[model samples]
Target: MSRLKNLKKLLTVLRVALSLVAACTFSTVSSAALEESISQPPDDYVLVRRVIDARYFTPESVVSRPDAAGTQGSEETWPDIKLRPSLNLKEALQSNIAREITISEQDALSKVVLREYGFGQKNSLQAYAAIEEKIVELNDLGAPENLKAGAVIKIPALPRMALSEPNLLNKYNKIPKGSMYPSLSKVTSFDAFNPVTQAFTEKPVVSGDGRDGSPLVIEHLWLPKDYKDHLGGIELDQSYEEVQAQVISVNMESESLAEDYQSIPFLSAEERMIIKSKLSGQPKLKPVLIVLDDGWPNDEAFYDSRKFVSEALEMIKKRFNYPVALQHPSSQSRVFTDYPKEAFHARSIHKSLATLVELEPSRVWDDQRVRVVYIPLSTAQVYSKAMLEELVVLRLIDDFMLGARGDPVPDKEVKAKRKIARDIVKRLKQDIGVKDLSTDKAIIESALVFADLYAVASGNPYVVNFSWTTRKREHKFTHFDFNQGILVSAAGNSSLNNCKSCRPNLAYSKECECADNAAAEERWFAVRSVSNQDVVAVMNTARDGSLQCRSSIVGSRSVDPLAISFNGYVSDSICGTSFAAPRVAWLFAAKLAYIPPQEFSIYDAPDKGHKLREIVKKSRQGGASGDQYGLDIKKLFEN
Candidate 1:
């Protein structure tokens, strides 16, 4: 009986031991399956389940793991893997972590997974395949077709080796070669005398005459019909009839009158005295009209237009004693016209000149005190699309260098920096020899051209009208003496689309809208921010006192008085803020004509906007509200 009991006990102990062994075997198999479920990282990289707090993951931080026997040990006995002194530990750890991104319409699967986050174009196909597979496994995408638009997915961390590999596609990574600007075959120098002549020095690619190697003719003298006839054979390339018709078209004569009555004869001495008496007390110095735009008409067409404009102004001076004779300093009326497409539009120049001379129907003249100077500095034909993009890239590099320094650099160093900037531009052009239309070249070139022209327009007490606007407004236009006079710029025609949130309002206003789909509000803010005492920005309004849908708004927050004018034609079909700006310029010129030279110096001082706002307020008409002021040519002549 004792032997049987002992056997039972022995059997029970053996069964218990067998149960423990079976449990251990099941646990081992389960651990293997769990390990296989989680994707393994590529060699030389560790899988980071979660990023440790950066404060605790310092260079002094140590990583600990179990011993090779897979058994936990005392803290001191566990291996401590110290980070290398040369390693950027934070960056290294961050690179190994997965990143989440939502696909954009512009994003391609290959670009996102391979070129953007994984190895670049220089990597092998096997490397790309590995990355794609890792991405699919990590996101459970199953297949490439499953990666649809707006889908969120995880990008697998890149291998450790990728950090050491240079990315050639990054423009910042490429070291610019020695003397980039000076060594280029086309670009010569960025000296103040002639900064960017790369596009101008070479013959224009477009087919046209009078673009290059043509003598520039400027018509400064406005001769009376009597003087023209006496000087006989003065070679008016345009017929007398044509000149008469142009004069009528510009509102120099009543269009309702007979053709025989259209001719403007010489004024009698009595008529001159009567006009002179009416202009008493105004400044003797003539106000300057600086037209900074694409080049004016070329050769004969240019001369004829100038002759007609001058003669028409002379007629006003003789008949009404208005200040018609424009001040000619050095006998040069047209300053810069070096581009190929200078003669593209004669009507634009004609309309601008006519607007400066007089406002139609109301017949309000610029008091005959306006002088004209043309600068052809706003044409996009000078550069290929590819060249323009290269220029922008160069500008970005320059901005980065300057921003990194964060200190005021000396003049000598500034020149050196400019040279480096030019060099980069030249090198980029060489790399991208292909010609294509640039996405943002027009805006970039507008700023560059204005900068160059600003230097040329300096030194004279002038009212400069820029019928253009650009997104780039931070350019340091050297040698531009803003003290000379004020700049009247058009508040761009970029407000066509209304902000959906601010419906029924033709344009976006800061008070009612935040942003638009086209980001036009941001652009409008940029345009308004550039305005001050020295720069007067004008917007367009319709005859009904409503803002033109296509006219950019000067936000209510602006301290500068908003100058709004009729954007539609009073005489011809021409319209836009382009026409509105010159009308404001003309009005400002009239105001400046009464201000003494000593008082005119105030424009150079800060807070000059106070005085400018006052001027705009005093001359403003009935079609304005709040901070806005509409232009009235008649109010300009008021005391």
Candidate 2:
């Protein structure tokens, strides 16, 4: 009885202690809430995250709290100037005496022209108005009609001014301090170790001895001059400024139309859930893969109807890659076709990107700061072998805007759309090879490019689902620019030229009407023999997820075991080289994450693609061979 009484007393004391502790906890929470309520919130600029390496980001460390709250403060000191945009500042536009000038393909309402005509950054409104008047004068046939080729129009011939201060061109040229990530120049100053050769060099090596590698040979292909002329004719008459203005107009109209579009119009709630599920455990990158597919005609059901293509897009997102979808399935019988209106713009944009990267090799390292767009086979048909080589030497494009596609068709309709696309293409082409890109940095970096050459010909016609056929070889043509970045392409989906189901019997000979009976072996040579150091022609892996002696293309120069999606499922029936190409691109991007931009930039030195190629080659392992010919990527980099 005595012990029980003592236990009860102990319990009473324990209860009182617990209640006191709970009260103190509640009091602390209440005090914090009150302090938070009284304190001013941090400004958005203070909260904005700064990108460290263009690849890595770190949030601002600034903190806001009540004066009485004794929390530790951040050490960073900021400048006193406000970062917000200035509002309602009125400026006047001044124009010099004007002279008559002829408008030609070479003519453009560029910043230089604007400045020469006495317009400055402070005169944007006046500059825009003057350019608009020129466009209106050139387009005699009302809205949507293009400026005729060779039709000379009068323009102001103001005396060229000194590249004046406060000019728009100079302002754009100057990269503001703290605007860009810290320069990679310092990081890349040191040498790299080559594990394969056990030597210290500037960077890794791919093949053919260290920094003394041979020049890469790339096969150039071209469309008949007539075909190119037919497709590219629209550009013959357009100027860069005119087309750019038109593209801007179209985009503005698109934005207006999009205002009424349903949020998540094409994808359903279930589909969104599916996407979420797919993306759940995947690695996210700073850059998004912008899948630029062709859209069908604007029918309510066409975009609204939930379908297989939508799911396929989700699957693509699930492949540890993120996608920014621009268009979906086309109404055409096949997913990819020739001569689509959008194809012209896609091709033009690709050429523009390639040129820009070539001029500023540092652009290759700009992961999302720059973009990688994926276009269909229609775009690939425009490049002939020779034109491709020529593309490397062209002037860099300053800016590009995509031709709008998808629901909510613009009011001006197809004619307006055609005019817009043609003008843009024309502007892009005319602007090429004219600008002086001598000052652009040749910083080497890992770049990604995907060519969806489905049923396309590179001097030889490729049968649908069949990649191999007799191809015209142009071994003599080679380019050094191919080594500037990693160029991933698909080994076409083709088979052997057999008896019953052969394509045209005269594929390699006289005029034959059947599909060619070219085998995988032949296809391998056709695709892989492009002879570019950075080119990696990829073949689809077998259904069992292995790189064996399957019916897929086989060669020393080709890679294997790439997975493709049909309706977004890798196991689905719709499999081809088109799907395989992106996989290799993703692989390259993943490997690039491990390397600093400075490292890739250093390799971009004029020493040839040797440094860049070697870095890629050394990082790769688990191929069919220990030599350059192996296609497997089992253990790309050892931990």
Q: lDDT: which candidate is best?
A: 1
Model 2 local distance difference test score: 0.27
Compared with the true structure, all predictions reach lDDT values of: 0.37, 0.27
Q: Model 2, stretches more than 4 Å misplaced?
A: 1-372, 376-484, 497-530, 543-569, 605-608, 619-634, 637-639
How well is each residue in 378-486 modelled by candidate 2, as lDDT tens digits? 1122321112121111111101111111222212222222322222222222111111111001000100111111101111111011111223221111122333344
Give the 10-residue window scoring lowest on summed lDDT in candidate 2.
246-255
The C-alpha stretches of model 1 lying farther than 4 A from their native spots are 1-183, 186-282, 298-346, 355-368, 378-460, 472-481, 497-520, 524-526, 529-534, 557-561, 568-573, 601-604, 607-614, 622-628
lDDT of 1 by residue, 27-70 (tens): 99999776534422111111011111111112222232223112
Q: What number of clashing residue pairs does each candidate have, in the order they appear? A: 7, 25
